[model samples]
Target: MPIVKNLVTQMSGQIQVESQLGKGTTFTVELPFQSAEQEEHPCGGTLDNPVSLEGKHILLAEDNAVNMEIATEFLTMNGMKVTQAWDGQEAVECFATSLPYTFDAILMDMQMPKLDGCTAARQIRALSRSDAATVPIIAVTANAFAEDMAATTAAGMDAHISKPIDFAALCCTLGRLIGKSSKN
Candidate 1:
């Protein structure tokens, strides 16, 4: 909630609240954004030559259903095959059971039920498979603190993408990481 409020305020937006005493409270946040036609703006790159995320197999680990659905939709739309894992434990197990080198990369949410992403990443790195240390494991989370990033690195994550995710950055990062992995 703090993060949401901060983001809204930073974007010169307003948050409205409606409270009914015996009922519940509703909050509405409105943020300003450039239209699709707006070019040469922040977040980088043009829409016409957008980063290609095609033909890569990605393992996505997110506990939130709505977040998972949104991520899956965008990833699939960009031609990447996604394997969903509802939690960090499931993510670890999914990777463990997968054939080595099957996943080009992993998008792992930091906070989750059962095991957290850091632990899951560590476990994945500890595996004996040939790709265990080679595959890119990207930490996707709301924890953008410096310490949080350090923790992910300590746990064997190759990169970090703070939420709410920047789609352009995500795509470029995936492309760069996967491309690098394929070379090795």
Candidate 2:
């Protein structure tokens, strides 16, 4: 409930929750937006361009099998190598045990059974490895809120991507974070 409210507020929207005993709860969300009359970039210059992830290694931590598969497929399609971890604890362990710079980046899910994403990120950041402080840690989460973004940043994540993940945004973010540019 709080997460929903935070997400609404983060999007410059409002949410009202009404609850009655023995009944149910109703959530009202109001979002402000302007209508788009035409395509902003009809030629699709940047949209048509492919983002290269060649030779980049990504550590992906996701508990859901379906999500993990989909994310992995997307990354592989973009030419990136992916290593999967089912939970945050495993993710932390993987990062800890790996050589410095073994992974170019980490795509972390916020919620998990063992340790949560924030805790895992903190653990990774605290490690003595040279890449611990340098590797890009990105939060791939369903929690799309200002507070959520703040929390990820505080936990040493480099960026945040909301679920029903945007592949283009993911690519752009990865490219920017790793100092690579998408090909035109």
Candidate 3:
């Protein structure tokens, strides 16, 4: 007889597998549902002074040093903790090796050395871990167009923000994903 068991996590159901006699065996685990702790947005209302992004952790992947510096300063000033990668490859590597659920959101640059944002995002979505796949990835690129938006969305990004990033827009995007409203 083959021994069997069931397990569940915070965003899915139980996954099971079996083995054969004198052979190898395997199993699958389903993730449980994630708890939505925050309340739904009240559409178009000036969010109660907007939500403060204080202490939130953000991962920024941009190959440009100047842009990275500017973004880092902006996010830090708003009380967010920022971790940066110089290119898309680094971003994928970081995400793959992170200490489980370590990121609140990711700001991905479309063009980079080694790997572009699209490929990196697709890889991230295919990760074996649930959180890795579910974490919000927001594309930050200079390509502002309808086609660009469609491409990014198809590549697994949760949202898209054009470059020369607008401070207000960035705040709004962050708020929507993490369940906060613009504080500024």
Best-fitting candidate, measured by lDDT?
1
lDDT tens per residue, model 3, 61-147:
999987898899999999999999999889989988998678888999999999999999998888898577678899999898999
What is the lDDT of every predicted structure here? 0.89, 0.85, 0.80
Best by TM-score: 1
Of candidate 3, the 10-residue stretch with the lowest lDDT total is 1-10
lDDT of 1 by residue, 14-128 (tens): 9999999999999998888776776542335666666567888999999998789878988999899999999999999999999999999999999999999999999999999
For candidate 2, the 10 contiguous residues with the lowest summed lDDT are 38-47
Q: lDDT of candidate 2?
A: 0.85
Give the Cα error of residue 76 in candidate 1, in Å.
0.7
- By summed lDDT, the worst window of 10 consecutive residues in model 1 runs over 39-48
Of 1 and 3, the candidate ranking higher by lDDT:
1
Off by over 4 Å in 1: 1-49
Tens digit of per-residue lDDT, candidate 2, span 12-67: 89988899999999888999855453322222344334445788999999999888
What candidate 2 gets wrong by more than 4 Å, as runs, is 1-50, 180-184
> What are the clash counts of all predictions, listed in order?
0, 0, 9
